[model samples]
Target: MSRRPDPTRRSEQSRQAIVSAAVDLCVEIGYAATTIEAIAARAGVGKQTIYRWWPSKAAVLLEHMTRVRETQIGFPDTGDLRVDLLAQTSAVQGLFASDTGAVWRGLLIAALSDDVAADGVRTLLQAAVVEAKGRLATAQKTGELRADVDLDMVVEIIYGPLYHAWLLTGRPLPEAYMEEVLSSVFDGLRP
Candidate 1:
Protein backbone atom coordinates (compact mmCIF):
# COMPACT_ATOMS: atom_id res chain seq x y z
CA MET A 1 0.00 0.00 0.00
CA SER A 2 1.13 3.53 -0.78
CA ARG A 3 2.03 5.69 2.20
CA ARG A 4 -0.34 8.55 2.93
CA PRO A 5 0.97 12.08 2.12
CA ASP A 6 1.87 14.01 5.26
CA PRO A 7 -0.50 16.88 6.07
CA THR A 8 2.39 19.25 6.96
CA ARG A 9 4.14 18.41 3.68
CA ARG A 10 0.92 18.98 1.78
CA SER A 11 0.42 22.29 3.51
CA GLU A 12 3.92 23.42 2.54
CA GLN A 13 3.38 22.40 -1.07
CA SER A 14 0.19 24.44 -1.16
CA ARG A 15 1.99 27.43 0.29
CA GLN A 16 4.74 27.24 -2.33
CA ALA A 17 2.15 26.96 -5.07
CA ILE A 18 0.38 30.06 -3.86
CA VAL A 19 3.58 32.05 -3.72
CA SER A 20 4.58 30.94 -7.21
CA ALA A 21 1.17 31.86 -8.57
CA ALA A 22 1.37 35.29 -7.00
CA VAL A 23 4.74 36.03 -8.57
CA ASP A 24 3.60 34.90 -12.00
CA LEU A 25 0.38 36.85 -11.84
CA CYS A 26 2.14 39.92 -10.53
CA VAL A 27 4.55 39.80 -13.45
CA GLU A 28 2.01 38.92 -16.13
CA ILE A 29 -0.75 41.23 -15.06
CA GLY A 30 1.00 43.80 -12.90
CA TYR A 31 0.56 43.89 -9.11
CA ALA A 32 -2.39 46.29 -8.92
CA ALA A 33 -4.53 44.29 -11.32
CA THR A 34 -3.84 40.99 -9.58
CA THR A 35 -6.24 39.95 -6.82
CA ILE A 36 -6.65 37.34 -4.10
CA GLU A 37 -9.42 35.60 -6.02
CA ALA A 38 -7.25 35.41 -9.13
CA ILE A 39 -4.32 34.08 -7.14
CA ALA A 40 -6.51 31.40 -5.59
CA ALA A 41 -7.82 30.34 -8.98
CA ARG A 42 -4.30 30.27 -10.47
CA ALA A 43 -2.97 28.24 -7.56
CA GLY A 44 -5.90 25.84 -7.66
CA VAL A 45 -6.81 26.68 -4.06
CA GLY A 46 -9.73 28.46 -2.48
CA LYS A 47 -9.66 32.18 -1.56
CA GLN A 48 -10.03 31.25 2.10
CA THR A 49 -6.90 29.15 1.87
CA ILE A 50 -4.86 32.22 0.96
CA TYR A 51 -6.49 34.32 3.69
CA ARG A 52 -5.73 31.58 6.22
CA TRP A 53 -2.00 32.01 5.63
CA TRP A 54 -1.55 35.64 4.49
CA PRO A 55 -3.23 38.89 5.48
CA SER A 56 -3.53 40.26 1.93
CA LYS A 57 -2.46 39.95 -1.70
CA ALA A 58 0.52 42.19 -0.99
CA ALA A 59 1.65 39.86 1.76
CA VAL A 60 1.67 36.94 -0.67
CA LEU A 61 3.74 38.92 -3.20
CA LEU A 62 6.17 39.95 -0.48
CA GLU A 63 6.60 36.37 0.67
CA HIS A 64 7.14 35.25 -2.91
CA MET A 65 9.87 37.87 -3.46
CA THR A 66 11.49 36.93 -0.15
CA ARG A 67 11.78 33.32 -1.20
CA VAL A 68 13.16 34.21 -4.64
CA ARG A 69 15.79 36.66 -3.36
CA GLU A 70 16.99 34.41 -0.57
CA THR A 71 17.74 31.55 -2.94
CA GLN A 72 19.17 33.57 -5.85
CA ILE A 73 21.19 36.47 -4.41
CA GLY A 74 24.61 36.03 -2.81
CA PHE A 75 28.19 37.36 -2.60
CA PRO A 76 30.89 34.76 -3.06
CA ASP A 77 34.57 35.00 -2.09
CA THR A 78 37.10 34.25 -4.82
CA GLY A 79 40.18 35.68 -3.01
CA ASP A 80 40.45 38.69 -5.36
CA LEU A 81 38.13 41.61 -4.66
CA ARG A 82 37.80 42.46 -8.36
CA VAL A 83 36.93 38.90 -9.24
CA ASP A 84 34.53 38.60 -6.37
CA LEU A 85 32.82 41.88 -7.21
CA LEU A 86 32.58 41.01 -10.88
CA ALA A 87 30.80 37.78 -10.03
CA GLN A 88 28.41 39.54 -7.67
CA THR A 89 27.63 42.32 -10.12
CA SER A 90 27.12 39.83 -12.92
CA ALA A 91 24.61 37.98 -10.79
CA VAL A 92 22.78 41.23 -10.14
CA GLN A 93 22.64 41.92 -13.87
CA GLY A 94 21.29 38.45 -14.56
CA LEU A 95 18.58 38.85 -11.93
CA PHE A 96 17.41 42.13 -13.35
CA ALA A 97 17.28 40.60 -16.82
CA SER A 98 15.01 37.75 -15.76
CA ASP A 99 11.24 37.57 -15.25
CA THR A 100 11.84 38.00 -11.54
CA GLY A 101 13.23 41.42 -12.46
CA ALA A 102 9.81 42.48 -13.71
CA VAL A 103 8.26 41.25 -10.48
CA TRP A 104 10.86 43.19 -8.52
CA ARG A 105 10.13 46.37 -10.47
CA GLY A 106 6.45 45.85 -9.77
CA LEU A 107 7.24 45.54 -6.08
CA LEU A 108 9.25 48.74 -6.24
CA ILE A 109 6.29 50.54 -7.79
CA ALA A 110 3.96 49.12 -5.13
CA ALA A 111 6.41 50.24 -2.46
CA LEU A 112 6.00 53.90 -3.41
CA SER A 113 2.60 54.14 -1.69
CA ASP A 114 2.17 50.99 0.38
CA ASP A 115 3.94 50.87 3.73
CA VAL A 116 3.90 47.09 3.93
CA ALA A 117 5.41 46.64 0.48
CA ALA A 118 7.97 49.34 1.14
CA ASP A 119 8.99 47.71 4.39
CA GLY A 120 9.24 44.34 2.71
CA VAL A 121 11.48 45.71 -0.06
CA ARG A 122 13.62 47.55 2.45
CA THR A 123 14.03 44.46 4.66
CA LEU A 124 14.79 42.17 1.76
CA LEU A 125 17.38 44.53 0.22
CA GLN A 126 18.99 45.18 3.60
CA ALA A 127 19.56 41.47 4.07
CA ALA A 128 21.35 41.28 0.70
CA VAL A 129 23.50 44.28 1.58
CA VAL A 130 24.42 42.82 4.96
CA GLU A 131 25.76 39.69 3.29
CA ALA A 132 27.80 41.75 0.81
CA LYS A 133 29.17 43.88 3.66
CA GLY A 134 30.53 40.79 5.39
CA ARG A 135 32.55 39.99 2.30
CA LEU A 136 33.90 43.54 2.20
CA ALA A 137 34.90 43.35 5.86
CA THR A 138 36.76 40.11 5.21
CA ALA A 139 38.64 41.72 2.31
CA GLN A 140 39.65 44.63 4.51
CA LYS A 141 40.94 42.29 7.16
CA THR A 142 42.97 40.52 4.48
CA GLY A 143 44.44 43.79 3.22
CA GLU A 144 42.72 43.40 -0.14
CA LEU A 145 40.74 46.58 0.43
CA ARG A 146 41.75 49.93 1.90
CA ALA A 147 41.68 49.76 5.69
CA ASP A 148 39.85 53.11 5.91
CA VAL A 149 37.31 52.36 3.25
CA ASP A 150 33.72 52.62 4.40
CA LEU A 151 32.01 49.30 3.71
CA ASP A 152 28.57 50.90 3.48
CA MET A 153 29.77 53.50 1.04
CA VAL A 154 31.63 50.93 -1.02
CA VAL A 155 28.51 48.79 -1.25
CA GLU A 156 26.45 51.74 -2.32
CA ILE A 157 29.03 52.72 -4.90
CA ILE A 158 28.95 49.25 -6.37
CA TYR A 159 25.19 48.52 -6.24
CA GLY A 160 23.72 51.99 -6.33
CA PRO A 161 24.51 52.34 -10.03
CA LEU A 162 22.90 49.03 -10.83
CA TYR A 163 19.65 50.07 -9.15
CA HIS A 164 19.75 53.43 -10.85
CA ALA A 165 20.26 51.81 -14.22
CA TRP A 166 17.41 49.41 -13.61
CA LEU A 167 14.92 51.96 -12.33
CA LEU A 168 15.81 55.45 -13.49
CA THR A 169 18.13 55.42 -16.47
CA GLY A 170 16.81 52.34 -18.28
CA ARG A 171 20.29 51.57 -19.52
CA PRO A 172 21.49 48.03 -20.17
CA LEU A 173 23.71 46.52 -17.46
CA PRO A 174 26.02 44.58 -19.71
CA GLU A 175 29.34 42.91 -18.85
CA ALA A 176 31.30 45.91 -20.11
CA TYR A 177 29.33 48.21 -17.81
CA MET A 178 29.93 45.91 -14.86
CA GLU A 179 33.64 45.92 -15.59
CA GLU A 180 33.75 49.71 -15.75
CA VAL A 181 31.82 50.12 -12.49
CA LEU A 182 34.06 47.70 -10.63
CA SER A 183 37.18 49.31 -12.10
CA SER A 184 36.19 52.81 -11.01
CA VAL A 185 35.23 51.66 -7.51
CA PHE A 186 38.37 49.56 -7.06
CA ASP A 187 40.65 52.41 -8.12
CA GLY A 188 39.77 54.19 -4.88
CA LEU A 189 39.34 51.04 -2.79
CA ARG A 190 42.88 49.76 -3.37
CA PRO A 191 45.19 50.04 -0.39
Candidate 2:
Protein backbone atom coordinates (compact mmCIF):
# COMPACT_ATOMS: atom_id res chain seq x y z
CA MET A 1 0.00 0.00 0.00
CA SER A 2 1.08 3.60 -0.63
CA ARG A 3 2.35 5.55 2.37
CA ARG A 4 -0.40 7.15 4.44
CA PRO A 5 -0.73 10.91 4.55
CA ASP A 6 0.38 12.60 7.72
CA PRO A 7 -2.61 12.94 10.00
CA THR A 8 -0.96 15.85 11.82
CA ARG A 9 -0.54 17.83 8.61
CA ARG A 10 -4.04 17.00 7.47
CA SER A 11 -5.51 18.08 10.79
CA GLU A 12 -3.61 21.36 10.60
CA GLN A 13 -4.90 21.96 7.06
CA SER A 14 -8.48 21.38 8.16
CA ARG A 15 -8.02 23.78 11.05
CA GLN A 16 -6.72 26.51 8.74
CA ALA A 17 -9.56 26.01 6.33
CA ILE A 18 -12.10 26.35 9.12
CA VAL A 19 -10.53 29.58 10.32
CA SER A 20 -10.40 31.03 6.81
CA ALA A 21 -14.02 30.13 6.22
CA ALA A 22 -15.08 31.73 9.47
CA VAL A 23 -13.30 34.98 8.58
CA ASP A 24 -14.69 35.05 5.05
CA LEU A 25 -18.20 34.40 6.28
CA CYS A 26 -17.90 37.20 8.82
CA VAL A 27 -16.72 39.54 6.07
CA GLU A 28 -19.53 38.51 3.73
CA ILE A 29 -22.43 38.12 6.11
CA GLY A 30 -21.35 39.72 9.41
CA TYR A 31 -20.81 37.95 12.71
CA ALA A 32 -24.46 37.44 13.56
CA ALA A 33 -24.94 35.42 10.40
CA THR A 34 -21.73 33.43 10.57
CA THR A 35 -22.54 30.10 12.15
CA ILE A 36 -20.97 26.73 12.69
CA GLU A 37 -22.94 25.19 9.86
CA ALA A 38 -21.92 27.86 7.35
CA ILE A 39 -18.31 27.64 8.38
CA ALA A 40 -18.38 23.86 8.17
CA ALA A 41 -19.94 23.94 4.72
CA ARG A 42 -17.54 26.58 3.44
CA ALA A 43 -14.60 24.73 4.91
CA GLY A 44 -15.80 21.44 3.35
CA VAL A 45 -15.65 19.72 6.68
CA GLY A 46 -18.25 18.38 9.06
CA LYS A 47 -19.77 20.62 11.67
CA GLN A 48 -18.16 18.31 14.14
CA THR A 49 -14.78 19.29 12.81
CA ILE A 50 -15.38 22.98 13.47
CA TYR A 51 -16.75 22.21 16.90
CA ARG A 52 -13.83 19.93 17.58
CA TRP A 53 -11.49 22.85 17.08
CA TRP A 54 -13.49 25.79 18.44
CA PRO A 55 -16.23 26.16 21.03
CA SER A 56 -17.95 28.87 18.99
CA LYS A 57 -17.71 31.05 15.92
CA ALA A 58 -16.16 33.85 17.94
CA ALA A 59 -13.38 31.57 19.10
CA VAL A 60 -12.70 30.60 15.49
CA LEU A 61 -12.47 34.24 14.42
CA LEU A 62 -10.15 34.88 17.34
CA GLU A 63 -7.82 32.26 15.86
CA HIS A 64 -7.69 34.27 12.65
CA MET A 65 -6.72 37.37 14.62
CA THR A 66 -4.08 35.41 16.46
CA ARG A 67 -2.59 34.09 13.22
CA VAL A 68 -2.57 37.58 11.73
CA ARG A 69 -0.70 38.87 14.76
CA GLU A 70 1.83 36.04 14.80
CA THR A 71 2.53 35.92 11.07
CA GLN A 72 2.01 39.49 9.85
CA ILE A 73 1.76 42.15 12.53
CA GLY A 74 4.82 42.90 14.63
CA PHE A 75 6.44 46.17 15.68
CA PRO A 76 9.65 46.79 13.77
CA ASP A 77 12.76 48.36 15.25
CA THR A 78 15.19 50.34 13.13
CA GLY A 79 16.46 52.45 16.05
CA ASP A 80 14.27 55.20 14.57
CA LEU A 81 11.00 55.48 16.44
CA ARG A 82 9.26 57.48 13.75
CA VAL A 83 10.09 55.07 10.96
CA ASP A 84 9.22 52.03 13.00
CA LEU A 85 5.91 53.49 14.20
CA LEU A 86 5.00 54.50 10.68
CA ALA A 87 5.74 51.00 9.40
CA GLN A 88 3.73 49.32 12.16
CA THR A 89 0.82 51.74 12.03
CA SER A 90 0.69 51.52 8.26
CA ALA A 91 0.39 47.77 8.50
CA VAL A 92 -2.48 48.14 10.99
CA GLN A 93 -4.21 50.68 8.74
CA GLY A 94 -3.92 48.23 5.87
CA LEU A 95 -5.55 45.54 7.98
CA PHE A 96 -8.41 47.86 8.89
CA ALA A 97 -8.98 48.57 5.21
CA SER A 98 -9.17 44.97 4.05
CA ASP A 99 -11.44 41.94 4.48
CA THR A 100 -9.43 41.16 7.59
CA GLY A 101 -10.86 44.35 9.01
CA ALA A 102 -14.37 43.03 8.68
CA VAL A 103 -13.45 39.96 10.64
CA TRP A 104 -11.88 42.13 13.31
CA ARG A 105 -14.98 44.32 13.45
CA GLY A 106 -17.20 41.32 13.83
CA LEU A 107 -15.07 39.96 16.63
CA LEU A 108 -15.17 43.27 18.44
CA ILE A 109 -18.94 43.28 18.22
CA ALA A 110 -19.12 39.71 19.42
CA ALA A 111 -16.84 40.47 22.32
CA LEU A 112 -19.49 42.79 23.74
CA SER A 113 -21.64 39.85 24.83
CA ASP A 114 -19.29 36.92 24.92
CA ASP A 115 -17.09 36.81 27.97
CA VAL A 116 -14.70 34.34 26.36
CA ALA A 117 -14.31 36.47 23.31
CA ALA A 118 -13.91 39.58 25.42
CA ASP A 119 -11.13 37.95 27.36
CA GLY A 120 -9.48 36.77 24.19
CA VAL A 121 -9.65 40.17 22.56
CA ARG A 122 -8.37 41.82 25.71
CA THR A 123 -5.41 39.46 25.79
CA LEU A 124 -4.56 40.17 22.17
CA LEU A 125 -4.78 43.93 22.69
CA GLN A 126 -2.70 43.81 25.86
CA ALA A 127 0.04 41.89 24.08
CA ALA A 128 0.21 44.54 21.40
CA VAL A 129 0.27 47.32 23.99
CA VAL A 130 3.12 45.71 25.86
CA GLU A 131 5.05 45.32 22.66
CA ALA A 132 4.43 48.94 21.70
CA LYS A 133 5.43 50.14 25.15
CA GLY A 134 8.67 48.20 24.99
CA ARG A 135 9.54 49.88 21.72
CA LEU A 136 8.54 53.27 23.10
CA ALA A 137 10.71 52.77 26.19
CA THR A 138 13.69 52.18 23.94
CA ALA A 139 12.84 55.32 22.00
CA GLN A 140 12.52 57.26 25.23
CA LYS A 141 15.98 56.12 26.29
CA THR A 142 17.34 57.31 22.95
CA GLY A 143 15.79 60.77 23.44
CA GLU A 144 13.35 60.23 20.59
CA LEU A 145 10.58 60.95 23.06
CA ARG A 146 10.49 63.13 26.15
CA ALA A 147 11.25 61.25 29.33
CA ASP A 148 8.09 62.64 30.89
CA VAL A 149 5.77 61.59 28.11
CA ASP A 150 3.27 58.98 29.25
CA LEU A 151 3.86 55.87 27.20
CA ASP A 152 0.29 54.70 27.71
CA MET A 153 -1.14 57.97 26.52
CA VAL A 154 1.32 58.07 23.66
CA VAL A 155 0.08 54.69 22.39
CA GLU A 156 -3.50 55.91 22.57
CA ILE A 157 -2.63 59.16 20.82
CA ILE A 158 -0.99 57.25 18.02
CA TYR A 159 -3.78 54.73 17.41
CA GLY A 160 -6.92 56.47 18.62
CA PRO A 161 -7.76 58.37 15.46
CA LEU A 162 -7.60 55.34 13.24
CA TYR A 163 -10.05 53.45 15.45
CA HIS A 164 -12.39 56.42 15.63
CA ALA A 165 -12.56 56.95 11.89
CA TRP A 166 -12.71 53.29 11.09
CA LEU A 167 -15.08 52.07 13.82
CA LEU A 168 -17.08 55.07 14.97
CA THR A 169 -17.68 57.01 11.77
CA GLY A 170 -16.92 54.05 9.48
CA ARG A 171 -15.06 56.21 7.00
CA PRO A 172 -12.55 55.19 4.38
CA LEU A 173 -9.44 57.34 4.11
CA PRO A 174 -6.28 57.38 2.03
CA GLU A 175 -2.68 56.29 2.59
CA ALA A 176 -1.63 59.61 4.11
CA TYR A 177 -4.04 59.29 7.04
CA MET A 178 -1.62 57.66 9.45
CA GLU A 179 1.18 59.86 8.22
CA GLU A 180 -0.79 62.92 9.23
CA VAL A 181 -1.60 61.40 12.60
CA LEU A 182 2.06 60.71 13.17
CA SER A 183 2.90 64.25 12.13
CA SER A 184 0.40 65.66 14.59
CA VAL A 185 1.78 63.42 17.31
CA PHE A 186 5.36 64.37 16.55
CA ASP A 187 4.85 68.07 15.81
CA GLY A 188 1.78 68.89 17.94
CA LEU A 189 -1.42 70.58 16.71
CA ARG A 190 -0.83 74.20 17.69
CA PRO A 191 0.61 76.43 15.00
| TM of each candidate vs. truth | 0.90, 0.94
- Stretches off by above 4 angstroms in model 2 are 188-191
lDDT of each model, Cα atoms only? 0.87, 0.89
State the lDDT of candidate 1 residue by residue for 1-191, as single tens digits. Answer: 99988999988888989999988898799888989999999999999999999987778888877877778777889888789888888888888888788778888888899887888899998998899899999999999999998899999999988888898988776667788888777888989
TM-score for candidate 1: 0.90
Across residues 1-191, which tens digit of lDDT does each residue of candidate 2 receive?
A: 89989999999999999998998899899989999999999999999988887889988999889989998899999998888999999999999998999988888887899987898899889999999999999888888888888889989999999888899998787898999889887854111
- Backbone clashes, candidate 1: 0
| Error at 137, model 1, angstroms | 0.9
RMSD per prediction, one decimal? 1.9, 2.2
Candidate 2 backbone collisions, by pair: none
> For model 1, how big is the CA root-mean-square deviation?
1.9
